[model samples]
Target chain A: MLRKMRRRITIRIDMTPMVDVIILLLIFFFMTSTFREAEAIDVQLPHAYAGVRIPKTGVYHILISEDGKIYADNEPMQSREEFIQAIVSSRATNPNLIFDVKADQDVEYGVMLTVMEDLRRAGIVRFNLSIFKEAGAW
Target chain B: MAGANVGGGEGRSRTGRRRISIHIDMTPMVDVIILLLIFFFMTSQFKEPHGIEITLPKTDVPVKIPESNTVTLRVDENNEVYFNEEPVEEISKIREYLIARQTENPNLVTILDVHPSAKYKTMVDVLDEFKIAADETGVTKFSLAMKREETAPEGGGG
Candidate 1:
């Protein structure tokens, strides 16, 4: 008499390569990602082809809304004098402070010149005008 | 010599010092790494911090620029563009004019004179054009004109 025999085979796959790739991607994202901060005012920046990538720190923001209201570092200023005073006082502490003007697209051009003149009076000769990158403008 | 060989060459003693096969499960570690990766990937914004630079002179002293090497672009309230005080019907004329003028004269000084009521977007658009022209000519000389009391009268063409 003969007895029938049954055998089982197990297959294993190597997950090392997949896990290694995931870890590499994880590190890349962790290093390059920056959390977005909540903005005090919503500004619709205009598109421009010529601009440089501004740094994250050591800069001050002068925001102008579409309604022609100005804000210094997110604080609404009643007049241009207050804005100048704020910049002058801030410059007293940090001489290397860079002024960044973030104005809405609908804002008047005259308002920008006024802000720039005020910045010049506050001893700020060089400043940045923030703009969105136009894809095909270059 | 015979006593030295008694236990030194035993195969059982070598087997006793063999390294143990310790298998560590990597499923949990990989799961955590994938979770963190997803979180970062979702929250990351690909926005480049872009801005246009403007540098004003420290002193208010006005420097004289020759008319032969000067180009003034003036924008009005209705986003109408003017090239060298001449109203341009087609905006592309300004770009072509800038490129041609800048190529002809490297020392060309471009002035921006914008009316107060004009939209800010128009100024940036014109500045972008100037930049493109400058890149081709390898020279960039521009200034923001002081505030004008009133808008320049519109003309048909020059």
Candidate 2:
């Protein structure tokens, strides 16, 4: 008597091309995406017509809250003296440091001036005040 | 016997084929990637937060600001703006004054002296007015000055 024969079927899927495309897309997004810098405090900047772009490097961000609270690099300072000390220490390492003062629009001008005075005392002459661009006309 | 023979023949025919091609649907993946691309494209900002164009005072080294053809503006504690020690009733007056001044001098330099007790917004508004007026007439020299701190009064214990 003759024995019955059996057959086997095989299936294959190539994931190489699909994976290559996915990786390319991921890389594109990763390279192009830019994350907003985290701030220690929030400030509503005043609007001005003479707004100009500032360089990103060597900038020391100082945030002034609406209630006149001072923040340096996401850390709250107890007083202007403390803020100045921090700036002096940072400036010792980086002489080309540029202070970027971010003050709330509603904040009293006296508080902002005090901060400026402190920065001056710290030997930081080169500083920029952050302002929003005016909407309609220059 | 015939049914058994037919079943054996069918089984032998089934073993002839191998290597079946598998297809994975990538439409869903493509859709998701496109959505993400749109999201990022919309959210990305090219312009950095801008800074006011006026220069600040230096602590150690003081630069000589030209007094010739200069206009001095002051903002008081009550947000009142003064042009050359005279109170300005409207912002347009400032623009008009600068334009008229620019026509005569052409090299007009505007100096802003802001009081410490004034609101920050008031200072910005004055600056904005200055900027508009200066730009309209092609005047570039501008400086921001801080009010001198008050000296302590000589007195006995209260």
Q: Which number leads on TM-score?
A: 1
Model 1 segments beyond 4 Å from truth? A1-20, B1-35, B89-93, B150-158
Chain A TM-score for each of the predictions: 0.78, 0.74
- How would you class the docking of model 2? acceptable
Q: Give a tens-digit lDDT track for model 2, residues A82-136.
A: 9999999998998887778888998888887788778768876557778887666
Runs off by more than 4 Å, candidate 2: A1-32, A135-137, B1-21, B27-46, B57-70, B89-93, B106-109, B132-145, B148-158
lDDT of 1 by residue, A106-136 (tens): 9999888789889989988888889998776
Docking class of 1: medium
Indicate the worst ten consecutive residues by lDDT in candidate 1 chain B: B149-158
Residue clash pairs of candidate 2: none
lDDT of 2 by residue, B1-158 (tens): 35534545676745754547777776677677767766666666555778764344443444454567678788888889999999999855787888788788987667777787888888778877777776687776666665455321111000
Error in Å for residue A132 of model 2: 1.1
In candidate 1, the residue pairs with backbone N, CA or C atoms under 3 Å apart (3 or more residues apart, or in different chains) clash, namely none
lDDT of 1 at B47: 90
Clash count per candidate:
0, 0
The alpha-carbon deviation from the true structure for residue A35 of candidate 2, after best TM-score superposition, in angstroms, is 1.3
